[model samples]
Structure formats: structure tokens, C-alpha cells
Target: MNLYSIAIQQLTRQHMATIEALVRQQPEFDRVEDLADRLRQAGVRAEARYVPAEKLFIAVYGDIAQVEAALETLCRLNRLNCVPGSSSWQLVHQDHSITQPAVLVIHL
Candidate 1:
């Protein structure tokens, strides 16, 4: 498997308990600051949130290319497994859980 696939497989084993803890404490607000900072530096209007269901959601309004690049950088640095979609990027986390769906939506 390629490096990307390897990373995806690795996260599939992440314990859901950690995700649940994040949702309760809302620590993802601090955790995603780097991503938000990168988007803002690229002149994009962005916000990052951790849903109560243990999902990570990042919304960006700006040039599509810039938004995509920023997200790419974030994923690379954070070792996140993200698959690009038509209107958003599906961030694959643990596959064993239904509540940890991480998604990044781009707005023009």
C-alpha cells in the first residue's frame, strides 16, 4: 500500500473513547487552531468545530484552490487521511465508529 493508504489504515484503529472525550471537553477548538490559522493566513474566512457527535467539521469560504491547498497542508502536517470530494473533503477517522465522521466543506 502507498503511504496515503497506510495512514488511512492506521487511523482506522483510533479508539473511539478519545473522540468521545474530545466532544465533551471541546478541546478540538484548540486542536484545530493551526488549520484555522493557515486558512486565515490565506485570506479565507474559516471556522473549525467539533460536533457533539464526535465529528470534526471545518468550513471555509474563499477561493477554492486556496482553500484546498490550505486543507492539504493541514492534512499533511497532521497526518490526517483525507479524500477529496466534489464539495468537501471526507476526513477518514476510525472506521469502527459511526460518530466520528470528519468533514471539511468548502464554500465559494
Candidate 2:
């Protein structure tokens, strides 16, 4: 299975809460989950999880492209405040495996 890690900074409780709420809302995550499920159905065994911290919320997904797309969509929808490749976040993909694509979003 391919793995992609997406990290978003939580500059404030409000931003963190917003991100947490969005994660719980199934519809908000539908496209991403669907993409992961599709990969799993194809024998990829995809999964996604969120790691919360005092100043960050990291979302680990199965596909880098899909996760990137989803985050970009969120930005477009005004759900998020930054772009995928903006200075606010740093994205790194694993060279040997899909297990470690790190995406960091710095909260403004």
C-alpha cells in the first residue's frame, strides 16, 4: 500500500478544532477515503490516520497525490487557509517507499 503523510500546523485552538471537526465529518473526507479504498480494493491496503499535537494535526494517507488533491480542494473550499506547496507547509516523499511522504502545513 502507498502511504502519504500530511501535517497541518495548529496555530490556535480554533484551527485545530476546525481540522478535528473536518476529520470527523465523513463527507469532508469522502474523496480521500474513497481514493484510499479504491487502492485497497486493488490490493493496496490503503489507510489514513490523524496525529494531533499542541500545534499540529498530521494526516497520514495512502496516496500522496490523492491527499495533495484533497488538501488542495479543502483550500479551494475555504476549509483550509494555505496551498499544498505553499511556504506554510513542506512536502517530502519517500524515495524507496510510500510509507513516508511528509506534508507539513504551518498555520497562519
> What is the TM-score (0 to 1) of candidate 1?
0.52
User: What tens-digit string does per-residue lDDT give for candidate 2 at 1-108?
Assistant: 223222223346668887788676655345445434544444433454344453223334355655555555544543333334432344343243544324344322
TM-scores across all candidates? Answer: 0.52, 0.29
Tell me the tens digit of each residue's lDDT in model 1 across 1-108.
Answer: 899998887786565667676667554466565566766876778887656584566777867887778767766765667688887776555344545445565453
Candidate 2 local distance difference test against the native: 0.44
Give the per-residue Cα lDDT of candidate 2 at 12: 61
Residue 19's lDDT within candidate 1 is: 66
Worst 10 residues of 2 by lDDT: 1-10
After superposition on all C-alphas, the RMSD of every candidate to the true structure, in Å, is 15.1, 17.0
- How does residue 65 of candidate 1 score in lDDT? 84
RMSD of 1: 15.1
Clash count list over all predictions: 0, 0
